[model samples]
Target: MVRPLAVDVDGTLTRPKPDRGVDPRVFEALRAYSEEAPVVVATGKAFPYPVALCEFVGLPIRVVAENGGVVCIEQGDGDDPYGGGRFGDGVVYNGDREAADAVARAYEAEGHALGWGAVDLVNRWRETEIAVARDQPLAPLERVAAAHGQEVVDTGYAYHVKSPDVDKDIGLETAADRLGYGPGDFLAVGDSENDAEMFGVAGESWAVANADDAALSAADFVTDAAYADGFLEALERATE
Candidate 1:
């Protein structure tokens, strides 16, 4: 059987630029691959984003969103699409949004804007983590997070302040169980600190060329290309 594939969004699937858009090349690649095996969208993004991405990309609705804070799989038949026949406690939530909210309040009290501006859409719908735009100062945010017993993770695209208890690997495990597999049966791919935990748990892992130090150190292989190009490279190597 083709090994299940778990991939990150943002830096791993998107172009690093003004728009940070998804590379169109990956859409076809993903759609084709999902036909043979499960394709999991694992991201630090809020829940709704990856779900929609899966729909558009023509992949299954297996998502690890909000880091490892939320896990959801589409189990309903087409007749009642998303009508709740899921597994592992049905939309498992490991994160504590209240804690993250407290951290955000403290960070703002210290004069930080969460870096996304007054109309912060990046975190508006986020259910589990406090997401701050990368432009914000890391030290102050980290300090505030630590003060509130939260940890900070840099996903390359942004800074996430969330419960240390949750990470992508945890979500992947949940996703795996629901899909009737294990972490070791999956091929993990990503490009940032948030992906480190996922790399550690997968039987094999790939860090895209643009991956941060944490992901690079944890991955079993590093692609030569960056962003979506690197992601495609990893997919090719996995087949080979």
Candidate 2:
């Protein structure tokens, strides 16, 4: 049996930003899962987001944040393991910093109207993808990249310009290895193009009903419900 579950945050376990929070019912489902098996909250969000979620849900599950840039296992010591010089057996790909910066600089050099929102540098098993959010349409970004023979993928939350090799899949695999688990030991779930990698890496992957077309297509299964409902469904399936 799979020993634990690794779940995405936005649009998987919870809604996206502005409304960035988990559904109460889904939180309850997570609580239920925690009693039976370890449930890891794996997300592209920064460390604080998952930390808040875990506190809100009152569960001490593990968290893999920043798209695997950071991983912290909840400890029974009532203190954060990541805070005390314990990297928690995770490897963060530091190479993304340079690659992500290059992409950002390229976008700026083209004079495309891009929002300089916080960029989350991701290194998923040596594959690099720079995640950025913008308030305007993405067509301009795409048009700019098309001229260079590159592509910009719309992940709902943001526009991502990646190496086409690195993605959530690599991140999940890295996380599994760090946690001493394997593909057969965890259930992966998400709702966007950024999540495609994670889905591909898991033995069984699930997409929320409201997930993007690409994500839904890539998933091994689709839940009948959306967001929190999807998480609850997956949790139930994992425990069973």
List where candidate 2 sits over 4 angstroms from the true fold: 15-18, 55-61, 69-86, 116-130, 134-151
Error of 2 at 135 (Å): 4.2
1-240 in candidate 2: lDDT tens per residue? Answer: 545677888888776446766676777777766666667787766566677788777777467665655556654433563465344553355225455546566777867544644443332322334555657557766665555544566767767664445555665666666656785667888888777777777778889888998889888889888887777776676557
Best by lDDT: 1
Q: Go through the candidates in order and give each one's C-alpha lDDT.
A: 0.89, 0.66
lDDT of 1: 0.89
TM-score of each: 0.94, 0.75
Clashes of each: 0, 3
Please write out the lDDT profile of model 1 over residues 1-240, one tens digit for every residue.
Answer: 679899999888898756589999999988888877888899999999998998787666889999999998764322344455544366888899999999999888888888887798888989988899888899999998998889999887789999988999999999998888899999999999999999999999999998999999999999999999999999999888
Q: Model 1, residue 155: what's the lDDT?
A: 82
Task: Check candidate 2 and list the clashing pairs.
Answer: 127-166, 169-197, 169-198
- Candidate 1 — number of clashing residue pairs? 0
By TM-score, who's the top model here? Answer: 1
